[model samples]
Target: MVQPAPYLLGRFLDPIFAIGVGTLSYIQYERNTHREPGHTLYDLLQKKFFATKEQTQEKK
Candidate 1:
């Protein structure tokens, strides 16, 4: 008995997914490298979690 053709369209999906993931990674890397040093998550957490009373009051 002859076998039916494999689903060829499914093969194209992996490369498309890879390109999308790679593009996103490059964008994220560029943003991280170009950002100011003080914009890191640790600094952000410190600013949010450890703000002085005057600093907190200023938001009002």
Candidate 2:
């Protein structure tokens, strides 16, 4: 038998939305980290997102 409970449907979908958003943000962070030309992970992910994001960063 089928039920017509809209509230129950929404409650189940809420966690799915949150998980999807979190996964997307995490993937973006990983991409930015790997594509960055910095020598170390620390330097690449910490800097501003400028045009030189793909260019080599000089040592400070």
Which candidate number has the best TM-score? 1
Q: Evaluate candidate 2 by giving its C-alpha RMSD to the native, one decimal.
A: 9.2
Prediction RMSDs, each to the true structure: 9.7, 9.2
Q: What is the lDDT of residue 46 in candidate 1?
A: 81
Query: Which candidate comes out best when scored by lDDT?
Result: 1
Worst 10 residues of 2 by lDDT: 51-60
Candidate 1 residue 3 C-alpha distance from true site, Å = 17
The per-model lDDT (C-alpha) reads 0.77, 0.64
**Local error of candidate 1 at residue 43 (angstroms):** 29
Q: After superposition, how far is residue 47 of candidate 2 from its true place, in Å?
A: 31
Candidate 1 residue lDDT tens string, 7-58: 5346788678888889788668858788677776556878899999998899
Q: Model 1: runs farther than 4 Å from truth?
A: 1-9, 35-60
Error of 1 at 47 (Å): 38
| Candidate 2 lDDT score relative to the true structure | 0.64
Candidate 2 per-residue C-alpha lDDT over 6-54 given as tens digits, one digit per residue, 9 for 90 to 100: 6633887878978888878876786777755565444546665443635
